[model samples]
Target: MYCETDDELVELVERARKYTEDGKVADYIPALGRAEKCDLSIALYYTDGRCFKAGDVDKLFTLQSVSKVLALALAIMDNGEEEVFRKVGMEPTGDPFNSIAKLESQVPAKPLNPMINAGALVVSNMIEGRSTHDKLGRFLTLIHDLTNNTSIDVDHEVSDSEFETAHLNRALCYYMKQHGLITGDVEDLIDLYTRQCAIKVSCLDLARIGMVLANKGRDPETNRMIIPEGIATLVKTFMVTCGMYNASGEFAIRVGIPAKSGVSGGIIGLVPPSMGIGVYGPALNEKGNSIAGVKLLEMLSQRYELSIF
Candidate 1:
């Protein structure tokens, strides 16, 4: 069960979906645009193997930017903390996730943080891999191992669609390469990054992955350590500061938790020590967050006092 009052959570999701119309689905990425704007779902997983699900929880969606969190962790494991930080800064940029203006003005041109596209591209380059397939294979394996969902993998349809429309991302990578923030072939790095972004998962699958983060890298189901606890903490801290695109501060204040949201209207969040929450609402706010999903999280956080602060 999600908590003592599982039925209340169901009611919460139903209530939140009323606001779905306030935001629009992200259509620039044609694959994501195909999703029903009114679709909404939520799922929760706890370390003790308990689960709670609500409407449309089984709907599959691409991870989009949420994959940045896992990529950051894998990069740290492969490169260590100091080296990774030296390549990317830890500060948040108030600008949009894909904005190139910051790269032109910032000193040294290091990505402000790994949660954004520039930084994620840097982290993607940092991940251990000889080729695009190899890099994505390693990352995908780690995700499957942690979530124990061997069935999950890249959705090629979504990946192809994103690669086709990733002109803005291409510019970000090229800019970073010129500034020495990113190295190697820009095309190869962009390919791997886009592949990671299109990793497909349902809310339930995301909740399982989030559960491991909540448990500090331990898989609650098998009681196995996935990553070092230190890595997990660092990942969560970034989520708190920069995971919600430009709306992170508002999310941290209202929802009060460590979380990451994606352009596909999916959000993966954790309430430390045990609770993991996954939300999906194709309708997105101007800041690119799931409109109804955020509302549901707010209600749960307020009712359960799930914030770490």
Candidate 2:
């Protein structure tokens, strides 16, 4: 195990918790703004089914942008990779996750990658369903399989808040629609995308989900393949390149793990072939990542030599 005991993990959490004072919760979403900025917690799950936890491991947070990775994986499974990539490119962007500047500049007008809001919206539209309920059900089903938690569902309050304030995202959709990138009703796409972002998961649940990915889409205990190995590899590659909004490069250099962070201060990290990590700290850096969460991962990476690089 990367962390032998809960006490060892707690030490790291306390050290990283100190940095939470320097960051702030994301307030633009309104509902997300109510999060306790000082809150920090972590969980690590190994392939052997051992889990080590620290701080308030019961705390729940929305997936926010981190949902993009899961949605992208499902989209690829529903539609072949060739069809999915035709709608979204694989390149990383220097712009902020929600920025629409690149959409206007790129000749094809497709999103640079599914990690960005633009690309994620396109992926959301691609989820095969006859209606919003069907689409979200399909996504929740994937979440259930990944985490082995059938009770996992969306936080409707957070979903509503995002839908109300998603003007910038709607703008991106319209732009993409103009370029023939995304189809169907714009509002419907936004509804599905916002709910996808609002799906709630505790640190433990996140760790379990990460474990599946780290195990290359298999349930460690059952060894059942929840996702194809190729899709798992593709998603992890995006997590390395574009996961932390625009700070992905720095994170790669520092932590050297495949990770995706959400504005809700949740991060899903992987130590390939063995361990999965989940961290929650509603205090965010300027780039929208969990500041303390990132610090804790950096410390763990250094201490345990956990870098996949």
Candidate 3:
């Protein structure tokens, strides 16, 4: 009962694969290093329990920065948006995701918003828990609750790979500590943030999470609240405003969904009131967005008329 017929969805998948054939996979993380270039897939899940998938939909990939949306939403629910704002600003940085320029500027030293790496690290610290382990436990629970997927676990290999190369994020955490923007142990928070980013998921899981948000934090299938309504809207606003790094404006103009992308090359987007959609193309544009992913979303948005505006 999930789809009336998967034929149309199947056609879209074929188009996506053809459109993304030249895209490259992410290689920074050594574990993602050897992933096949042009590896593309998508999953679409509607509120009615119909699911459509195509291509390498089962392929496992790191959540990367896409985890920011969940962390930020949970932080706001745990401590209120006002408190979370004290640690991370809502304004767009207009700088690179890993840029330390804003961190060093007295004009606005705080990480701009949770979608960026620095801001996500700050948001991770704000999740209520006694220790990093406790915090991640809550995080894992949140993801599991949202996706209704119990088999999910941290990809230790990916986590370790990110940890080794996350020097920039670590430095940003240390600087934030010096600025009183982050009050916890810097090293601990950075490690916690890095670990959280390493949670592996597929297009199905990503689409399910997006579906919950599209349903205003309610699980469409179970009709249970996964995220509170208010916090869901808040997180969606942030995603719309700042989700795609410096390219968020362009994405909003084109794809017109409150979406988030991971450096691992996945994009989770939604068409509110209709469905949750996911696109995976590891080849990234210069802005760190998935080039093929963006193209596919633009076409989908145009065909479906899903833009909020």
Q: What is the lDDT ranking, best to worst?
A: 2, 1, 3
lDDT of 3 at 239: 85
Number of the predicted model whose lDDT against the real structure is largest: 2
The alpha-carbon deviation from the true structure for residue 212 of candidate 2, after best TM-score superposition, in angstroms, is 0.8
Please give the range of 10 consecutive residues that has the lowest summed lDDT in model 2.
Answer: 1-10
lDDT, candidate 1, 192-221, per-residue tens: 988899988999888888999999999877
Pairs that collide, model 3: 2-50
Residue 262 error, candidate 1, Å? 0.3
Candidate lDDT (C-alpha), each = 0.89, 0.94, 0.82
Candidate with best TM-score? 2
lDDT of 2 by residue, 57-104 (tens): 988999998899999999999999999999899999999998988988
TM-score of each: 0.97, 0.99, 0.94
